[model samples]
Target: MNKKTIGRVVKYLKPYIPLIIISLMAAAATTLLSLYVPILAGKAIDLIIAPGIVDLDGISKILIRMIMVILLAALFQWIMNVINNHITYRVVKDIRKKAFDHIQSLPLSYLDTKQYGDFVSRIIADIDQFSDGLLMGFSQFFTGLVMIIGTLCFMFTLNITITLVVVLLTPLSLFVAAFIAKKTYNLFVKQSEKRALLTGMVEEMVGNEKVVQAFSYEDDAIERFDKINDELADVSLKATFFSSLINPSTRFINNLVYAAVGIVGAVFVLKGRITVGQLTCFLSYANQYTKPFNEISGVVTELQNALACAGRVFELIDEEPETPDKENAVVLKDVKGSVMLKDVNFSYVPDKKLIQNLNLLVKPGMRVAIVGPTGCGKSTVINLLMRFYDVNSGSIQVEGNDVRDITRKSLRDNYGMVLQETWLKAASIKENIAYGREATDEEIIAAAKATHAHSFIKRLPNGYDTVLGEDGGSLSQGQKQLLCITRVMLSVPPMLILDEATSSIDTRTELRVQRAFAKLMAGRTSFIVAHRLSTIMEADMILVMKDGNIIEQGNHESLMKLGGFYSDLFNSQYKNV
Candidate 1:
């Protein structure tokens, strides 16, 4: 067992110390009462000296006392179980909540590299495994220890020779159980890892089932799933096979000790060193003493698996969160939306440069359109501007202050963003439109009308009150885009980012929405990224980017006259027209 991991798991028990103390006390009581019953039974047996001379009254009294002790032992055992369950589940709950909260604080770069399904398995499946292990340890492990110690004390009071024999043979059982447990731990860890991989693959395939079917990738998907499933089965079988060896292996050793005690005590009885009744008590204590070894061996097996699961959960909780904001960071307010990027360098991966020493300046209320082929770093520019990623070198400034110098929340509050892909939660239309802000029904309707979504919305059974499913279920791509557009129309932030925002809408609806966008963009600084050349013809300035550099810059007429890259791009789009 890892001492460090065990220590960390123990730390969660600090809050429940009082309950743990009470439970331990109950375990002690239960074990003591249970151990005393054997002594009472031996005394009742001693009362029957001969068939005709048996003391019925004394035997009857001892039997009554034994029954009372047994009942009290059972009651304490019940209390311990209830308390153990409470502590185990509460600890698991705390660990899960901490892991989930830490995931939210983790950097986007870190999240991008992880599998969503694996995270789900860690929070749900792994934690549940940890919970089971913890509960078993709490319920059985400590009680077994107490039983072993208590039985030993009772046996020593009867005879020293038999006690020594049992003690001498006990280490064999311990060594056997320990050896098997060490072998199973790593196998259990591998099993958990493979299970997570399988979960991630299943989630990915199911979530994109449409794409899988469209590409006829069913056979390939099944092949990949089988590969992971086979690996999981291999590790799980090894772990189960190793852990299963602990029980019978230890039981065989314990039985040897039991037989040794019975032989030694019987010899002592024959020589009159102890009576037959006393020999009977020694035999019962011998069985009681060795029985805990078998139970504890089982507990050890469960604990090994639990600790393995816990280690995975703790790894997530301990991940480094996104860098914290500076203590004296400025809060952006009353933003004029003048933006500047000077000598900026950035790359998603080190040693593979994407944008380098890029420089640009946009005055307040200027409409800047960035046109480029795919993978030319157009959306990346928006990412840097929004501080989703910081530039590797140089600086980006809003108004006159460096973006890093301003609080992220305050900086983002001044901008409205709409992407080609739309997002909607499982909620009513009114709730979705009013997300992140308070708005009246009147304001929601007006914004929806402006984006040309109010017509279809009213056609629904509940209109604004209609509760949509996850990601706007059954809504056409165009309808979803309009709802996203309505979100920005309601707020009308001082700055805007539109990355192919109307690509999903029909031409007629796109024309109507473009008029609405022109009205919305009249006095706001906007960065529009569009593949369609016609949409950005009226931009105050157009920048044509190639391989992360601005190859051409001018208005529509000037760029057309320059007859360079921008001219060719525009002409290509209108060639068919």
Candidate 2:
């Protein structure tokens, strides 16, 4: 357990000082009440049995006092529990909200490498375990301490020698608890980490279950899951087993102390050094004193578990977020659609340069096509242009204004994008198309019609109001592409990027969508990244790329006449047909 991380968790409780005070007061009251009950019981025995003649009225009054004390103790315990629960869950809610919001602010580079299930486990499962541990440990720690101290003081008053003996034996319980906790803390940490891995594996497998079935890899998937599940079970067993030993070990020591109190008290009574009533009270106090040792040991185990969970949560909270915009960053306005990349260079990782010294320019209303083989940095160009990533060196400017000088939101606002992968939330079809902005029913239907999505949408049971499943699961690939195109059409950005936008559509349907796109691109600057050579034959400018370098540039007819890389690529596609 990291003290620094655990300290950070305690800092979250600072704002709830008032609630903490109330809970502590309730715990103290409960402990005091419980301690007083034993005293009343001891006194009742003395009042009735110590006298030569039984005092019936006195016994009844003492019994009433003892019952009232016990009842009050139970009530305070319930109140303490209620307050602790409130404090614990409220803290957990705040932590989850902070963690999720922090995730939203984090950079894509950080999120890209993280698994969804791991994130979910940190936000939900880890926080839950942390909260439960805090609730258990916090309430018990306060009450148990008070109960031990009160019992010790009462026992000292009854017999100082016995109290001293009990105090000396008490260190044995602490030594045992600390030793076991040290051994189990690392085990619990391993268990928590394994649980997160198992959750990630399950999520990854289920999310790609279709692929698994298509490839008939069910046995492989099951084997992988079994390996992870077995690791989790092993770690969990070791952690819980070690922690479980704390209670019984402490209990054994406590039973010895109880026996010692009885034997020593009998000797004192035989010597007439202590009265029967006082001996009886010392025995009662001894039981009460030893009970807190067991409670403390149990709470120590819980604290270790809680700290393990809190460490994971704190690690997520402390991740570096996206770099902030400059103080004088300007909002990109009056965009003329002219774009320029001057000596641009970028790489996802250092020493593995993907795009180097890339430079390009396009005038307003130009239809520029970026053609390249896979991994030729075509998508990297789009990513840099949209400021999803910034160039490692050089500049990207829109209308002569450097993109880095402009706010990211304003820079992205001027572009519409459609990728090969379509993303649709579980909402009405109309909502998915009108995503980010409001539009009238007529405008929505018009955009859908323009992209040839209206016909199939109308055939649905609820038409535009029909809800979609994950990524439009019920829709065909062609239908989903059309919807994405419709989304871009409704956006009506000054610049458009279509990256394999209509790859899923049939040739016949693609032609119709292309016509709509031609109309959409009439006055806007456009970038088309395509593998099919025929799609970009009429593009005003075709930049042929090979290994991140532009090897050829011109219209289709000029490129064919040149008979360069572009001609060879164009010929390769037609040679197969």
**Which candidate leads the pack in TM-score?**
1
Instruction: Give the distance in Å from residue 166's predicted Cα in candidate 2 to where it truly belongs.
Output: 1.8
lDDT of 1 by residue, 1-577 (tens): 7677799998998999999999999998999999898888888888888879999999889988998999999999999999999999999999999999999888777888999999998999999999999998999898888889988888888888889999999999999999989999998889889999999999999978999999999999999999999999999999999999999999999889989988888888889999888888888888888888998999998899899989899889889988778999999989998999999999899988888888999999999999989988999999899988888999999999999999989988899999998999999999999886899999999999999899999999999999999889889989999999999999889999999999999999999999999999998999999999889999999989888888889899999999999999988988989
Off by over 4 Å in 2: 50-53, 272-280
Error of model 1, residue 523, in angstroms = 2.2
Root-mean-square deviation of every model = 2.1, 2.3
lDDT accuracy of residue 70 in candidate 2: 85
For model 2, residues 1-577, the per-residue Cα lDDT tens digits are: 5789778977998898898888788887888787777667766666766447777788899888888888888998898888888888888898889999999878887887888899998888898888888888777887888888888877877788888888888889888888889999899888889989989999998988889999999999999999999999999999999999999999999988998999999999999988777777788788888888898888888888888988888889999987888889988887879999999999988888888888898999999999989999998899999988888999999988898888889988999999998889889999999996799999999999999999999999999999999889689988998998999999899999999999999999999999999999998999999999888998999999878788889999999999989999999999978
Q: Which ten residues in a row have the lowest lDDT in candidate 1?
A: 1-10
Report lDDT (CA) for all predictions. Answer: 0.92, 0.88
> For residue 137, what is the lDDT in candidate 1?
92
**What does candidate 1 score on TM?**
0.94
lDDT of 1 at 390: 85
